[model samples]
Target: MSVSLVLTVMREAVIRILVVSGPIVIVAMVVGLVISIFQATTQIQEQTLSFVPKLVAIFVTLILAGNFMITTLKEFTEYIFRLISGM
Candidate 1:
């Protein structure tokens, strides 16, 4: 493909990836921030305290958004395939 076409595809791919993972990442970041605040206040420095909650929140986010993520990826893949076929 031409340079512009390649760049366009790459840009779209990045956007798709960001859209798909944004929710999970946002949830994990919020959970981590809250845990850090709690740790600071309580002097509870248990490592797992921070890790477990973020992990669980990310997992739950994935479960909730799984279908949307899959659909996004599928559409991106189809778009790429169509571009290839057109070339």
Candidate 2:
């Protein structure tokens, strides 16, 4: 592929990755921040406390967004196949 085409594909891949993972990462970050604040206030510096809530939140988010995520991935796969066929 040409440099421009390669760049376009790379850019699109990055954008897709961010779109797919952004919500989960943001939720984890927010959960971590909230947990940190709570830990600071309560002095409950437990490892499980920090991890469990974030895991639960991420699972819930994944369940809620699973369909959308699948659709996005399917679209990207189709796009790549189309590019390959054109080539």
Candidate 3:
């Protein structure tokens, strides 16, 4: 691909990734921070405390958003393939 085409594709890929992953990542980050604060405040430093809730929240978010994420990725993939075929 020419430089411009490559840049366009990369930009699209990054945007697609951020759109697909943004919510879940944000939720997990928030949850993890909250849990960490809770742990600190309560002095309950269980090694798994920070991890479990974030994992569960991420899983639930993924389950809820799975179809949308899949659709987005599929569309992006198809677009990429079409661009490749055109090239």
Q: Best candidate, lDDT-wise?
A: 2
lDDT of 2 by residue, 25-62 (tens): 99999999999999999999999999999999999999
Candidate maximizing TM-score: 2
Predict model 1's lDDT versus the native: 0.93
Better of 1 and 3 by TM-score: 1
* Ordering by lDDT: 2, 1, 3
Each model's TM-score? 0.96, 0.97, 0.90
How high a TM-score does candidate 3 get? 0.90
lDDT of 1 by residue, 1-87 (tens): 689988998899889989998999899889999999999999999999999999999988989999999999999999988988997
Better of 1 and 2 by TM-score: 2
Candidate lDDT values, in order: 0.93, 0.96, 0.92
